[model samples]
Target: MASSIRDELLKVLIEHQPHFLSGEEISRRVGCSRAAIWKHIEELRHEGYEIEAKPRNGYRLVYRPDRVAPEELAPHLQTKRFGRHIRYEYSTPSTQTLAHQWAREGAPEGAVVIAEEQVQGKGRMGRTWHSPPQTGVWMSLILRPPISLAEASQLTLLASVGVQQGIKRVTGLPIQIKWPNDLLIHGKKVCGILTELRGEQDQIHYMIIGIGINVNTTSEHWPEELKKIATSLAIESGGHLHRATLIAAILKELEEVYQEYLNSGFRVIKSKWEQAAGMLGKTITARTPQGLITGVAERLNESGALLIRTDQGVIPVYSADIDWKEI
Candidate 1:
C-alpha cells in the first residue's frame, strides 16, 4: 500500500537522520526504483517535511508537517498502543464517526483517527464544535476498557484527566475541567470532549473518546457566536503551539492514566479528576432530564456520577449538560 511504502521510506530516512541517505540506497532498502524514491521524497516535502538533497549526498529530514500524519507524529509519539496505529486525514466529517465505524469493523483498542480538519465536528449535547484546518487537535481514541456498561461512563472522567494532564504538560498552563467533559482556561472554553460507545447492557464493545482542542486557533477563526466562549492556546498564551506535538503528549499521558484506571480502578482517576474539576464543592446548576437541578456540587461518587446536595438532600447525576458558574 502507498501508506506502507511511505512509512518504510520515512523509516529509512529517519534511521539515517542528519546523514545523507542516497536515493539508490533508499530505493534498495524500500524496494523501489531510484525514480520512485525521488517521487516519495518530493511527496514528503510537499507534506511539509523539509528535506535537503545534494548531488552526491542523500537527503536529510529538516522538519515535519504541522498535522498528525505518521511522518510528523510517529517520531514523537511515545505510547505503547494508544497512538501506535493511526489513520491520518487531511479532512473528515468527524473522527468520532470514522472511529466508531472502525470499531464496529473490529478495529483494535487504541486505534486512533486524527484529522487536520473536521467538516462536521461535534461537542457534547449535540452542539457544533468549531474546528479549523491545521490549527487544532481533532482525534478520536478507541478504547475497549475492561469495564461494564455501567462503568463505561467513568472513562469520560478518565479522558478528562488525561486531556488536562496532556495540555498542562504541553502548554504549561492551568487547565480546568468543567465536570463531565469540558476543559477550560481563564474561564473560557479551550477544549471539549465527546464520549460515545457501543456496548451491551452488561459489557462494553468499544468506547470512542473524541477530544478537540483549540491549539493554534485564533480569534478571527472563531465565528461571532463562538468568539466569547471559545479560545485557543495561541490566543491564550500569545504563542502558537505545535498541534502534532500536543497530540503526542496527550496520547502519552492518556495511556499512562488509562492503564492505571484499568488496573487500579477509578479511585486514582476520580481523585485527579476531582482535583482539576470545576464546580466541585461549589454551587452550580445542571439541566438534567428531570428538570434544572441547582445544588452545591459535593463529590464524584465511585461510579463517576456527580453527587450534588440540593435542598432535597443528595442526588446522583448520571447525565446532564452542566454549565459551571463559579458560585
Candidate 2:
C-alpha cells in the first residue's frame, strides 16, 4: 500500500515534470492526504530526487538521480513479463539468496529481486562478488522452465548472450562473453552471471539467475587485486550510466531471448552465444574437477559444453574455469 502510494505520487510528479504541481493538486491525483503527500515528497528527496518547494508554487521536480528504484525503472522497461513484479531493496545480503527463498514460496516467473548494494554478493563456484553501493546492478531473476536438467544448464549460456546484447544496446561498447557466464569489456571483466536451479529427479522446480554488472563503478572502488582485471561501463564509456536504464534494457533483452529460447530452441541462442563469445579457436586452459586441461578452444556442442581440441582428442567440458591467457 505504501509502495503504491509512492508510485502514484511519483507518477504525478513525473507527469508534471519541469512544472510545479500544487500540494493540493498532487494530493487529489494520488488520492492521498496533503500531509501524506508532503511526507512522500520528502522521502523521494532523500532518495536523490531534487524537488524545489515554494510557499506559493508548491513543488517542482528539478533533477532525478540515476536510481534503480521501481519508479525509475518502470518508464524504461519494455518487457511484457520481466520486471513486472520487482522486489527492490536498498541493501541486502544477496539477491540470489532472496530469490531462492521467493522461488520456494512460489514466486512467479519473471519476478525480479534488485538491490542497490549487496553485502554478500555471490559469484560462480562459491566465490565472492565485489559489489559496491549505488554503482552497479545486483539483481536476481526467477525462471520456471519445464525443461530437463541437462537443457536447464544451457540457460547460463543464454544468460551470457542476453546480458551481452543488453549491455551492447545500452552502452554501445564492444562487450564479449568469456565462455559460460562472464562478460568482458575491452578484455576486462564488467559483468558476471550465476544461474542456479532446484529440482527433483526428472522434474524441475525453478531457476534463479543472478546478474551483477559494474555500471558506474570507478577504478578507485576496486581492491588492488581487481584493479587490473575488472572494469565498469563508466570506465570504458568515459561517462557514468543510469543504472535503471541499463537494468530495464537488460530485463527486456533477457526476456526476449528467453522467449526465443523456449519457442525456437537452443540452436539459435547457441549461435548467438558463440558469436558474442570471446577466445574461440585460441589456446586456453581450463581447471576442471578431474584435472587441468589445456587445449585449443573449439565450438560449443549441442548440449552447451565448451569443446576443446586437445592433443589427445576433442573433449567437451561441462563446467570449468577457463583461463584465457590472451584475453
Off by over 4 Å in 2: 19-36, 54-58
Give per-residue CA lDDT, model 1, range 1-327, as digits (tens): 777778788877766787888888888888988888888888888877789999988787777666678666776788899888888899999999999989999888899999999999988888888899999999999999888888888999999999999999988898889888799988789999999998886988899999999999988998998898888888888897888778989999999999999899999999999999877888889899999999989889999999999999999999897876643
Each prediction's Cα lDDT score? Answer: 0.88, 0.92
Q: Write model 2 residue lDDT over 181-202, tens digit each, in one string.
A: 8999878999999999999888
Best by TM-score: 2
Error of 1 at 110 (Å): 0.5
The TM-score of predicted model 2 comes to 0.93
